[model samples]
Target: MNSNKAVFDSLRNNLKVHYDGKRFSYKSKHDLKDKSQLLVLIRKFPEGIAVIDLKDAYPNVMDDLQALKAVGQIWLLSNFDSQEDIAYPNDPRMVIKVDDDLKQLFPRD
Candidate 1:
């Protein structure tokens, strides 16, 4: 498990400034098949992280699913804000009509 520890350390080191403004910590372990050599689990501190059961954004993420673990977990690091301000389900296609709000942000300039 030393290699796993290294991965965890690397992840934490990289997240030092990415998960700011939160107050939690998460640790996960997973085994991978032939596709991926490693499958690490993600989680948020405490009970703030939401659990996404279905495969939406990343299907490969499910390879490390565990019944006792929480899915769609967020973190409370020092760089990431408690919440994100990005919009979702927005289209960038000008041919397809989009809401005025998204149109302004996703103009075809």
Candidate 2:
């Protein structure tokens, strides 16, 4: 399995977390206040699909992606378009679809 595949598999088997109206209600009782992204996702996904977005360096994204995979949830990382040329500002990271693979989750319509 490639990186994405390995991550997805980890997510599928490891994390048993779900969201419900401003409540994380995870299977584990451990607190995750230190994990900023996790906290954000928990608070923001009160009534929507759970997803984590990453910005900044690629290595950081790789690590967080792995972590999120361990938790068995879907996530997205975005990149900024070239600042020098303003032809297009790349695409924003938004939820398009949910699938077992990355290819199917894009081009959100």
Candidate 3:
């Protein structure tokens, strides 16, 4: 199912950088459809990667969900972290969570 190949192509062709003056650019080797793909993303952009509505992106993918928690990259979808089962209840990084409302990050979604 090529749900949205154009989006995927864009992501693959032009890797976005955080531009923290680090000049770091990332290449996404895989799509964010499953845990394995998420792991590839982690391996590619572990330091500064953001995912919005992570559940919508990788629904029912346990490995992807766990990787999000393990890597601490998916910030906007804080609902996942607040769950009682998660290790972190009150995340100290609540300050940055506000960016989730920006919506411009993943405009095509």
lDDT of residue 56 for candidate 1: 32
lDDT of 2 by residue, 16-98 (tens): 55344343433433333334454344345434322222222223544554565455453333334422211111122543565
Residue 34, candidate 1: Cα error in Å is: 14
Give one digit per residue, the lDDT tens place, for model 3 in 1-109.
1368685555445534223343434523234667656545544543434443233344565555565666664432334554323222223345355366676667673
Candidate 1 per-residue lDDT over residues 27-50, each given as its tens digit: 232222421222222321232322
lDDT of 1: 0.33
Model 1 worst lDDT run, 10 consecutive residues: 84-93
Which parts of model 3 are misplaced by more than 4 Å? 1-30, 53-55, 61-63, 67-109
Mark the 10 consecutive residues where model 3 has the least summed lDDT. Answer: 83-92
lDDT of each: 0.33, 0.40, 0.45
lDDT of 3 at 78: 32
TM-score for predicted model 1 compared with the true structure: 0.18
Candidate 3 to truth, TM: 0.28
> Which 10 consecutive positions of candidate 2 have the poorest summed lDDT?
82-91
